[model samples]
Every structure is written in C-alpha cells, then in structure tokens.
Target chain A: SQELEQSPQSLIVQEGKNLTINCTSSKTLYGLYWYKQKYGEGLIFLMMLQKGGEEKSHEKITAKLDEKKQQSSLHITASQPSHAGIYLCGADPYGQNFVFGPGTRLSVLP
Target chain B: DTAVSQTPKYLVTQMGNDKSIKCEQNLGHDTMYWYKQDSKKFLKIMFSYNNKELIINETVPNRFSPKSPDKAHLNLHINSLELGDSAVYFCASSLGPSNQPQHFGDGTRLSIL
Candidate 1:
C-alpha cells in the first residue's frame, strides 16, 4: 500500500499569515492532488500536479510537487478566515487509486 | 447546480439492517470511487469504477458492495451492517483513475446503532 504522511495535523494562524502544509509519500507518486473541505462538507479539488517539480496555484493557494516525486506542499498566502478548513493531500501512486492524507485542520483567525 | 450528488445525506439504522447510498455525477467523468472516513478522520478508498467497469477494490469487507450502472452513477450497498460500519461515505469522480483530479459529493453520514 502507498502511504502518505501529512505534517502539522492542525494549525492556527492569523488571517494575514502565510502557511504551508507538507505531504510525504512512502512510494513514488503518479500524481498529487490538493483538496479543501469546509467543516461538514465534501472535498473540493484545489490542484493537481502530475510531473516532477510541477507547481500550480489557484488564487491564494499554491501547490508544488518536488523533484523526488514523493513529496508535495500546499502554500496559502495572506490567508483568510474563509480559508479555515481541513486540507487534505491525496496521492495516486499509479494514478489508479487515490489515498488521502490524515488531513490538516487549519484555523485562520480574524 | 450540484455537479456530483449523493442521496440520503444522513442515515441512522440498527445493526444487522441493510442500506444503500446512491451517487450521481454530471461532470462527464469516466471514473468514480467510494471512500470511507472513519471516526479518527482517516479517509480510505473502498472502491473504484471506470466507465461502468470495476477497476479498483480495496480490502473492504465483502458486506460492502459498490454497483455502477453507468458512468454517471455508483451506489454502495452494505448488507448486515454492523456498528463498525458507521462513517461518512463519500463519492467522487474523475476523468481518469491515474492522473486526473476528482470532484466530490458532500458525503453521506451513516450511523449504525
């Protein structure tokens, strides 16, 4: 089984602060995806990185996949209260199945 | 409009009963999956179907079955549900199983009493 470890199980920060969450995989990733879930809601696709060293951003959220193909990061700039939610990183080792991270619960305070 | 939707948003039933959750996606995606988020908040893949064909099946108990009648629908049926079967079940869809990002349904919260 491909395994993924997410750091900082939970985070609290001021609204304007910048934050980053890390996802490390035990196996090479076929692709990496970032998702955000508001409390009690379903997961929302944020970004997808397929190639090594790929990077993509959506508004204030940027995601990067390292060259090693086993690590990825999600960075949020000038975070806002509306960004507060549980962020999950999912890795597809062979691009056949997806396994999600344990999820990083983030709190962006006003 | 909701792109992906699941019916029976919340379910509460006694053990040994049978239940089914329905899912539909209008995204024109070719692949769909079923996932379970346990009480500990760990999301695990249970099953995956591509174009109405069973593609991925995890080590889930045989009691849990996923049926997809077409590319747009995937339904989960749990027979003789047990107390341990309670969790938030999610349905998702993607263009491909290997590389595309998926769209998800809000989720169905199930509780087996």
Candidate 2:
C-alpha cells in the first residue's frame, strides 16, 4: 500500500511571509505533482517533478522532489491573500495513478 | 472552455438511492480518472480508464462503478448510496495514464441523507 503524509496540516501566515509545505511518501515516487485548490473548488495543477533533486517554480510557488527519501516540498515565496488555499502533493509510485496527501490548508492573513 | 467538466455540481439523495455523475473532457485526452475526497481532504483514486479500457481500480467498493463511453467521457455510478458516501467526487483527464499532468473538473459534491 502507498501512503502520503503532509506536514503542518494547516498553516496561517501573514501577507508577504513565506511558508513551505512538505509531502513524504512511503514509496519511491516515479512522479510528483503539486496542486492548489480553494475551499470547495477544483484543484489547479501547479507543477510536476520527476527526477531526484528536480525543482519547478510557478509565479510565487516552488516545488522540489527528493526521490532518495521519497519526499517533496512546496514553497510559497512572499505569500499573498490569493495564495491562500489547500496545497496538495500527489505521488505516482507506479507511474499510473496518483495518491494524494491529506493536503495542507493555508490561510494568508492580510 | 472547460477542459474537464462534471455535471451536477452538487447532489443530495437519500441512502439506498442510486446516482450517477457524468464527466467529459474536451482536451482530447486519452485517459480519464475518478477520485474521491473524504471529509479530511484526502484524495484517493477510485478508477482510471485509458482509451475506454479500465486501467486502475484502487480496491474501490463494488457499489462504485466507473464506465467509459469513450476516450473523452467517464461516468461514475454509485449504488445504494450510504451516509459514509458523502464526499466530493472529482473527475479528471490527462493525455496518458502516467507522467502526465491532469486537468480536473470543479468536482461534484455528494451528500447522502
């Protein structure tokens, strides 16, 4: 069975501050994806990482994959109110279907 | 245009009733998937179909059936809906079953009473 665990189940940050969310998988990740979703809304894909030590950034968010430890991290730089949402990390252990983590809820206080 | 869309954004029904959620993708993707988001926001893959063929069914309950009419459409039918079935169901599609970024629909919220 594959499992994904996320750190800091929920986070609160002031505007302009930075925060990082982590996703650790029980199995090696063939691919890792990062997505964001507003409450009750559909998820929007942010980035995808496949190789170990790979990193990708979009706008204000950055994601990295550490294949050795089966870990991935999503970092937001200079957070804003618009960045407040649920950050989810998904891992593809078998290169087929994704198993998403429990998600990290982020709240940006202005 | 919505790349992936699911009909009936919200559904409310009594237990023991049957319901279905329809999904379509205009992106011409060859793969479609069904995912369930539980109350704690844990997203789990229920099914994945590629080119109208079932690719993955993650040990989901028999009551949950996924049908693919074509490469662009996948529908989920739930039988004997139970209160525990209340959750958000998301429909998504990708160019392939693996190593592809998926497009997601707004999701269908199912509530069983």
> Could you give the DockQ of candidate 1?
0.89
What's the lDDT of the predicted structure labeled candidate 2? Answer: 0.92
RMSD of each: 1.1, 1.2
Docking band of candidate 1: high
Model 2 scores a TM of 0.96
Deviation of model 2 at B76, angstroms:
0.8
Question: On a 0 to 100 scale, what is the lDDT of residue B42 in model 2?
Answer: 84
Model 2's number of clashes is 0
- What tens digits encode model 1's per-residue C-alpha lDDT throughout A10-106? 9999999999999999999888889999988899999999888999999999999999899999999999999999999998777446788999999
lDDT of 2 by residue, A50-110 (tens): 9999998898888999859499999999999999999988877784457889999999999
Top TM-score model: 1
**Could you tell me the TM-score of chain B in model 2?**
0.99
How much is the lDDT of residue A107 in candidate 1? 99
Q: Judged by lDDT against the true structure, how good is candidate 1?
A: 0.93
How well is each residue in B46-103 modelled by candidate 1, as lDDT tens digits? 9999999999999999999999998999999999999999999999999987778889
Clashing residue pairs in candidate 2 are: none
lDDT of 2 at A64: 91
